[model samples]
Target: MAHRLLLRRFVSVTLRGSSGPVRSRSSALFPSRSSLSWHGTGPPLHHQAVPATARGFCVSHASRVTFNVQNQADFAERVINSKKPVLVDFHAEWCAPCRILGPRLEKMVAKQQGKVIMAKVDIDEHTDLAIEYKVSVVPTVIAVKAGEVVAKFVGVKTEDDLEVFIKKLTCT
Candidate 1:
């Protein structure tokens, strides 16, 4: 119990230091004020009873699969020349939208395994690469083919948009 609280504090502090705004875990884990089960790091957060006053935060229970890239060289080698079109998401751990978009992307990749590959770059950590790609946001998803970027979307994007972009990327 104590460990959970401490971990939650650590997460909150870490998120505050990152680019995106931190969301209330209570609001994230719970939806309405009427919860079936109750748990707490700081306070009891019910899944169904999260009041609108809980906060303007939303957490979608989705799967977001990501590949962590170490540096520009590795990214180039792994994504640029890959047979499958690579979708790189430039994000930071703290970003809210990045968190929301993460799981959705995982499901998307799973559904379109042969046609697309999804990767992530921590812009905060990989500053140089993010700058090279001209990524000015927390969640910039880029579609690359034949070592060149074919499509780019800054901020949250739909899976359908990614699918269409991948289909359009030139295989050079």
Candidate 2:
């Protein structure tokens, strides 16, 4: 019980500063106020929820299927030249929409299994890729296949809309 309380405090502290996933054993024992659920040993905590009033608290989640684009060469090798279609999310750490959309996009992409791969690129960290891709805005999603960009969009989108976009790209 003491450990659970301590874990809860840790989660609270971690989330108080930034909006991201909180992994706590207590989260499984004691459900959070938000929509987080425990599904096995290590599922991405995308569903982890913190209080809305919590300052700097944002929910972030990533799946094992997702990859973070580290640099220009990595992008070229993993996304542009990959066998599967890659959904590239160009975003920034300070972007609120990116925080909201990040986990949601990961969830949606995970449902596709291996049919698609999601790549996250921080605009600040990978400015070159963002500029080359013409990502003037944060939360820009680009679909790349066979070394070419097939479709791209800006801003947040509903899960359904994103699925439709992926379907359109994969169907071709």
Candidate 3:
């Protein structure tokens, strides 16, 4: 069957080096080329030093300042127990003010450069967390430090206001 042939070809291509650069029909369908590569029938190229051009493909989460909260457990672990101050943004997808405020918060937090972190919580998806945190309105941002709520704000705030909030949070 065609499936068997395709599987064999994929396995052979993956396990052994091809004559030259091999482009599969599947890879042609996608905008980006395959990231996987093998060399000279030796071990996969992962063992070798990744080229400078390929460094962009790597993801380093340590540099990330903002992330989504998955559940109550995630909230407790990442926000409550965090060593650095965390700005928990409670929002909903359809909320217009939340949409406007989210990016501004992210930009402000990114400027902190690891001094602060932002945890985005979709109220609709995590209703329990929203209720527990007493988030009665969309675009509620709470600053938590040392497992306690330090400051909170409701609705959209200007970039200057956000910068002031971030500066105040980081200063303490």
How does each model score on TM-score?
0.56, 0.64, 0.70
Q: Write the per-residue lDDT of candidate 2 for residues 1-172, one digit (tens) a residue.
A: 8796566666566555555544444453455632244456654466444452323433343455698998888888899889999999999999999998888889888888778899999999988888899999999999988889999989999999988998998899
Which of candidates 1 and 2 reaches a greater lDDT? 2
Model 3 lDDT per residue over 45-152, tens place? 444322212112234443487889988899999999999999999999999999999988888888777899999999999999899989999999999999999999
Of the candidates shown, which would achieve the greatest TM-score relative to the real structure?
A: 3
Worst 10 residues of 1 by lDDT: 47-56
- Residue-by-residue lDDT tens digits, candidate 1, 21-56: 334555444435323343554334322222223222
Candidate 2: worst-modelled 10 consecutive residues by lDDT: 52-61
Question: What is the lDDT of every predicted structure here?
Answer: 0.68, 0.79, 0.79
Window of ten residues with lowest summed lDDT in model 3: 48-57
Model 1 Cα shift for residue 69 (angstroms): 0.6
